[model samples]
Target: MSTLQVRVARKVSEADGISSFELVAADGAQLPAFEAGAHIDVHLRDGLLRQYSLCNPPQERHRYLIAVLRDPSSRGGSTAMHDEIEAGHLITISAPKNHFPLEPAARSLLFAGGIGVTPILAMAEALAGAGADFEMHYSARTPERAAFLQRIAAAPYAACVHVHYDSGDAAQKLDCAAVLGAPRADTHIYVCGPGGYIDHVLGAAKALGWPAAQVHREYFSAAPVDEAGDTAFDVKLASSGQVFTIPPGRTVVEVLAEHGIDIPVSCEQGVCGTCLTRVTGGVPDHRDVYLTDEERAANDQFTPCCSRSKSAVLSLDL
Candidate 1:
């Protein structure tokens, strides 16, 4: 993907441990238009690239707003943005891309967990502008932990917004059963958050008989990968006829990258399908959540960023 240089225009503390960065074109030109639920890959110092959802309204083309959370266990992306990056600093970024875009439906329901509210906030704004029937439910560990609460409360769809907190009163907490207990025809639900929260909402919807196709979700992180079960394997490149030993503790992408084979990757967590490569032979462990059940069963492709080989050897159509 091509990269664009942009300048950090401003920074604002949205909540505890959460800050929103406003980026604008360094040359003061219009940026590519993007819809709700879009995200950009922010290229940080030291070859670190991170994806952040655009929280600003889609109608605004001059600036892109992204909120970042300072993760204690971060591998440097979030922490660097919080500590090193400052206003007026120029950074390279990929154009906006969306995997959790809002779908057209008669009625829509948005569920956000903590920092997941970023994209949903933009969706709420668009829905309100279109005079569509929609409502948003945001949940956080505490009221202070929720980012963009003030902006959401001031939106035109403020009346349709509901806030829930784990520390708040039980009576006002989120009632998954009440909201998703029954499925509505022509209605689609969009959810973006941590794996646990997404799973909880999706699980409740399924148990309530909601069609799987009607439920949509985006996971910020993949499920924990257990290295204990991992075993060393071999991956042979089809063109070069070269084989790379993928040790138990290493991933296919990491091993191949060290050998100067640069495979495009966005989310190393295996949630994004950017690094999916065709599999000519052998079985893939299929640890990713991006592929569907049918796709996994087909065994024609796999995400090398996180997946492993089930067999001792695997062949890639590189």
Candidate 2:
């Protein structure tokens, strides 16, 4: 993958545990243009790669802004960004890639939870710039934990944005049912946040008879799955007729790598669709949060990073 060397021009504490990093080209040249909802992969120490959404306006090319929440359970990515990286430090990152681009609609509704506001903030900026009709509801545990409160308040579309705090009064809280209301064909809903929060928003939409296509979501992390009953499985390569046995508690990617077969992967949790591979035969367990319901039902492609096979023998196109 092509990468860009960038200098950390500045780093500021955005909220309680969130820090925003401003990255500029190392050579002081214009960076690649990115659309809203785009994210860049930050390559960190120990070969750790993490994706962070760009929060700044999409029209700007001078710098890229990304916010990172110091996760206590981080597998070294967020911790390194918070401790090792500093202003004036040089870092390598991939160019922006957007899997959550905003779709056109007559009216848009956006819901953001905690740090999930990163992408939604960019979407608001893009929508505001286009003079499109949109409304945003931001939910946080508390005001102090919310990132970009000042930025959102200062935006030209400030009136269209609503802030909700879990610690605040019950009446002021985010009522998903009330906000979502009846589904309209011309109105689209976008949501991003923790798994439970995303489920709440999506569940409400589903109950309201909202079409799946009109409701979009991006998950920051997937819910933990119970693997106590997981069993061993075999994967067959269609190209070379090679078969590899994936043992219990072992991932397909790890086993494949031992056999000199490499699959590009990021966010090994299956949040990023980097290692998605075509399945020639057999049913996939489908543990990834990246694929939609329809995509998972197709069973033609699967993320080998974390997903496993339901059948005893699964065939891969590669």
Give TM per candidate. Answer: 0.95, 0.99
lDDT score for residue 93 of model 2: 97
Give the local distance difference test score of model 2. Answer: 0.95
RMSD of 1: 1.6
Report how far off residue 86 is in candidate 2 (Å): 0.7
- Candidate 1 lDDT over 180-278, as tens digits, reads 757898899999888899889988898999987888888777888778978899999989889999998889999999999988898887886789899
- Please list the residue runs of candidate 1 whose C-alpha ends up more than 4 Å from where it truly belongs after superposition: none
lDDT of 1: 0.89
Q: Please report how far candidate 1 places residue 295 from its true position, in Å.
A: 3.4
Model 1 lDDT-worst window of ten? 286-295
The candidate scoring highest on lDDT is 2
Where in model 2 is the C-alpha error above 4 Å?
none
